[model samples]
Target: MGVHTTNGIQGVSVSDDARNASARRGKKGLLIGSGVGVVALAAAAYVGACYHYKDAIPEGTTVAGKSIGGMTSEQATRQVLTLKHPNASTKANVTAGDQSFDLAPASAWKPDAEKTLDGVTEFSLSPGRLLDQINGGGEKIEPVYSVDKTALTTLVKKAAESKIDGAPKQGRVKFIGGKVSIVDGAPGHGVDEKKVADAIASGWPKKTDYTTELVEKNSDASDNAVQAFAEGDAKKAMSAPLEVSANGQSVTLTPAQVSDVISSTTGSDGKPAIKVDTEALLTTVLSRGDKMRVPAVDAKVVWKDGQPSVVEGRSGKEIDESKVAKIVGDALVGDHKATLAMKEQKPAVMAKDVNVEALPSTSMAHFESPFPTGPSQQARIHNITTAINRLNGIVVQPGEQFSLLRALGYEFTKESGYVEAGTLQGGLHLDGMGGGVSQVSTTMYNTAFFAGVQLDEHTAHAVYISRYPMGREATIWNPGIDNKWTNDTGKPILIKAHVESNKVVMDFYGTKKYDVATRTSGKYNIQSPKHRTVKNVKGCENTVGGGVPGFDVDVYRELKSGSTTVRTEKIHTKYKPDDIITCQN
Candidate 1:
């Protein structure tokens, strides 16, 4: 068809194949463009979803058994607080070989949110991440936990050592059927710390119980070497009793004592060694030994501004219990006797050893004696005060006697801060050295009596003084007489005496063992006083106070521990009548 000539006749005719081909091309183009648009929209939606969950904790992520998946920083932090913290009682039981140990890690499974969330993100351009974000989460995060590294490491190492690093039993000295014998040693395996640690880490914070195997360790000292030393040491240690002295005190270690604590063990140098239990050794020595102990000063309560506060006291030279192992150990292996060097004397009463809270208060056992009045009043007060000052701060050790004479160190005379006061001699009133000290002696005796101590040496006065308790009073002379007592309480006794408001106050501070109660029988065998004339004897005071009937009496002491009486003892006293005296010129 010619377009120009057919224009007047309404165009030329086209081919049907061309028209159909043109329509097909248009339809194909539209379909192709629509497919491209759908793909582009899907990509945009994927990118937006990825950005939505940016840096979020992966869904299904759990920390220390807590679900914190898909949580934001703030939400995760708040959820971390709700995680059930590991309790102190939570323990991990582990077994290695035949020995089992418990691991009580202090909050070892504690969740660490900051560490878990640090640089964590589930959003990513990668296909896998995109798919994961769309489906919630793809990663299950391993919980980050914190622990006491030092403590956990030490515990792990200890478990390892105890499980496998056991040395061959060197042998133990034991008494068998009344004869000394050695308990044979046994072989043990060595340890592998790295192995044990690796095994423990595999299940920590997740596993509560574990089992491991130990490898063998090489020992320089064979089991035979240890047993050999043990045999020889046992023979020597059990031969005889060892009289050991430390800080002026003596304790005899019998074969039984030696056999109880002495044992052979493998040394770090791979040599066989003898080890002694210092605590058991000292306890035996102190309990079974003779009376050679001195008072150990301990902490006590003091009144400051009328308020009670614990005041710590200094310790004296005493047997060093820590070093006693070596001292007695050497003697067990070498000599049969030992006089410990002075350096071995340590403070028996350590700061930690003092029990000020349980101090035997004066309220528990208190004694107060009034000052004797008259011409000798001032002089007697002086004598009593002097005696009390000397008595103060003197501690009576268990198994040792507290002798006033020894504690005074010298006879109380006019030159030794004492004066002539009213004293009873030959049933007459006279001035003598250390006269009023009898009041002090009585006060101290009462303290010991009510405080539940052993009354070793005490004598009643000649006359029955109304002021002092009848039959309970004691009299102390210058050089001969002394009030003595022993601390049978198994604890140190501290004497704190002072003259307060005309009264001699004596208090014994120690650990309270039991409550003491006394019952005195009525006076019997009464003796009438005599009438006597003092023919101007020098220093004889004209019968200041006299004329009292004397008699025999008995006192019963009941020691009770929480309403149960442990033991009771009776004390008897015989007093001579006080004679009525008339002065003559």
Candidate 2:
């Protein structure tokens, strides 16, 4: 009980029960306030820990068994480059079997930093993670590395292929000495390049090299299988030359000649089956060198009595593709001779062709190469004539691209009518198949340069040939190297090739679009030829300077309309130095 004062302060009185209730309330309030303070302290600790470790891998995180936690991605990448050692990558020489692993590094193995970071523990306040961070973090991330697997596989495969001493061959048809021979193979030990590549990839960016060994190889094709195939297919289809008759004329196709168009695969019945490339076979028979029937000749512009004249094109016969396959297949089982059905084909340029005399009457650009004086150069002239014939009177539409290889159908082999001739290879003028065709290519390149057409692609010869222009010439090889151009003019372009007694001429005739002015820079970076010893190549009589010094030059082409410059392009040629070869044995 409390006594109340009317005017001033009153003295409070407490009973035993009231005093107990007040004490209880005071104790409860103090306990609740203390609990709130503890919770505030815990929240501050969690925030501080999370903030301290943001943008960083958790502590005690390791890569390749080395600690890398608390480090940024850049810092972690640097550590991975070292791969736990300073000189580890310096001595990374690898070998397989007896062959050395000598290949241009496609690319070095790099640490997959992003992938590694994916495994890292990010900032988190979970109980387990918080406990882990308190006890110096325990997330272990495996080292991830990336490399070009294809390049590694190719390198290893090349090295392993050299271990072919006493190696078993896959059984297949072999054309030896113009005869079809069935080769046999057996199951044996061989180096597996893919397996070795995988093994190396697993431990890439490491220091050690592997001395790989041969593994048991499965038999690709059994000897019995190939022999059975030979009796079933090769014996009837490839044993003798195929006689293809059309237009009352017959031509012989040797086994070696036809081998390129034939393919072999396992049949559905588990027997070896042979497939004839019908389209390719048709093409082989239609090319000028091997055509059994006359093809339609397009109307062309020609010089007659020192004046332009239009030669009327005539209809010619083409082998009927619809019936040729069945006829050829049926003949293959018998005497290997079949008479192809022929049909009339119209010329691309019709009789009412465009008159050259009425349109552009003169050649816009022209180039020629003089014939060399030698009997060995006959093959070169023949190849030049063949290529020229294929490119003559060709019309390139506006915005069309022309590939010289495609026009000539570049196979450059005997079956394609190109024989062995002198061509530059490895700084030596050895007799190479389809050699003299480069002369035609050089002639065309010069003509196209002056024609002001866009040069899509062109490659210079490794060795300089004195006959062609010093820096404005081009050479082509199988598949990869080629001469290509685009007709920039908004008009049709005509290409004409003429073979003279003393020289080969190439002319480009069209609406005179632009006056292309060319200026060539002087040769720079001149290098003298090196003296070399020749062993494998034969028939070199010179012991002195067999080749000319190599140098680099740039040819500039400026297209103009009267006085204003339209566009400019530069063709840079770098010729390699040749060797003064001395054949000793």
Candidate 3:
């Protein structure tokens, strides 16, 4: 009976332990199911949050201190564009020298709206950004901006121009009152434009006010250095007066004059040095030389037995400039006086060098015009003689052109030795300078016509003058009317002009290569002179001009080389009527 009772107790105990273990396992399973349900609900909440703001800016995002969180891209762009800056419109005073310029930072810098919006939208779709927003962390987006560089640069330059002076000038030697002295250089102010521009570009976007300072520049050369180098030399150069002798004449330079030629300059070593300006010193020496110099006379050609004769030329004496310069330099350096050397200057055309072989021996053309013989026409004759002498020894090379105006230098004023005489004006004879030069022109034209040369330009007289050829003549007025001819003779030509008691003759000497023959279509288209009255004003003289009939003519020139015609040219001319000009008050 005891054993059976023990067994039943053991079985009851075991059954009781199994029922407790199953109850514990059932409670654990129910807890795990509840935990899974809670995890699923949290995941669904996270996914819904991400989907809700997928196309929108995440929360807790700000740009330029403006909260743009949870806003659309367009909304954020508007916010960025309308963001107000307190100092954006503020004007800053930029001063240069004595000038001040006003600069507006707001007008120079502007915010970029699209760039700001892009930043906001890009961050909204970022996985890390979404996680951060969900975790309650916020992001600060930087605002992008655009700056007008040109406008900013212009503003800086204007400020610089107003406040800054030009660069400092170096010290130099200046001559004043026959003395040598140093002119000092000054330091200058320069603007650091790049620095100012960079500052504006950096702070302007932030709406900050700033002031830029200009840079200071110092001059490397000044009065101290110049004076130290030149003072001793200047004093030594002027210690004693300089005596210069040239061409047997002597002149003394004053102490001040000696200082005038002593100049100060910087050497290759970049230090001031003293120098003697030979050119400047020569001015004084040349003055004495001029007084003692004898001018060389060139050999002249005169017609002897209808042929050219060479007149003897004389040599002249002048100071040797190079030797004199060396002497002057020595005097300035050590000596007190200089005896200048002289040299003999030979004429360009020597009498011994000129002969018939060196000259054009054959006479190619000759023309002469008679002048009125009276005391009243003395001035006119003298004028003609002056012009002829000027044109006496002109030699034209082969294929060279000749111009009468250029030969005479085209100066027809009283200073040029032209005397007042009767000149043709408005078909009347009037007293004017260079009046009788036309006589020389007419003679030269006829000579050229017979020389078989090419005549380039010529104008006939308004009124026919009996002194000249019937259809072959030319007249000249200063600067406007000219007579030109080219030597087509393939050889050199020499012009010889002479003035006689009543006639001026012009002759061309060259190798005769062609036989020139001329034919004229006799004067036609004759028109009678018109009688007209004149109402004179101030500076008018009472005069009556004789009338002459107008006519037209054509001249043909034929060139023959050994009886074979080479070329022929036609020269046509028209003369206007000589109207009766009455000048009256």
Number of the top TM-score candidate? 2
Each candidate's lDDT (Cα)?
0.65, 0.69, 0.69
* Candidate 2: tens digits of C-alpha lDDT, residues 1-585: 878775687777789899999999999999999899999999998888876665465566666654555455544554455342222334334564664443333243556767766635466667666666555676666756567787777666555544445444555665444456776665655566677777666664453466667566644566687787787667777777888788777767877766766655544344555556777776666543344555565565666687766667777776787887778766766788978898996655543644564545478888888868578678888988888887877765444567787566546777778888877776776777888888888888999988887677888899777888888888887655789886645345688887998688988877656799989899999998888877766645344555688999888999898998977878788998876877766
Q: List model 3 lDDT by residue over 39-68, tens digit each.
A: 999877766776665646656566664455
Residue 229 C-alpha lDDT in model 1: 60
Q: List the residue pairs that clash in candidate 3.
A: 96-163, 97-163
Candidate 1, superposed: residue stretches over 4 Å from native: 1-364, 374-376, 544-546
lDDT (tens digit, per residue) of candidate 1 on 1-585: 335345467665557887788789989999998899999999998788778867565655555434455445555564554444545567767676777777665444566867866655545677666565446564545546665454465576555555444733334445533245555555556345455555555666466787766556554366566557656775677778888886566767667666676665556566666677766665566554433344334444455685545445453344555566677778877887766544322332344443445444544467888875665388888888898877765555443556766565345655567877778887777777777888888888899889876677887787688898877878876334678875555445667879897799988877656789889999999998788888968766555454878899988999887989978888888888877778887
Q: What's the best-to-worst order under lDDT?
A: 3, 2, 1
All models, RMSD in angstroms: 26.7, 23.0, 37.3
Error of 2 at 469 (Å): 1.4
Better of 2 and 3 by TM-score: 2
Badly placed stretches (over 4 Å) of model 2 are 1-359, 538-546
How far is 278's C-alpha from truth in model 1 (Å)?
40
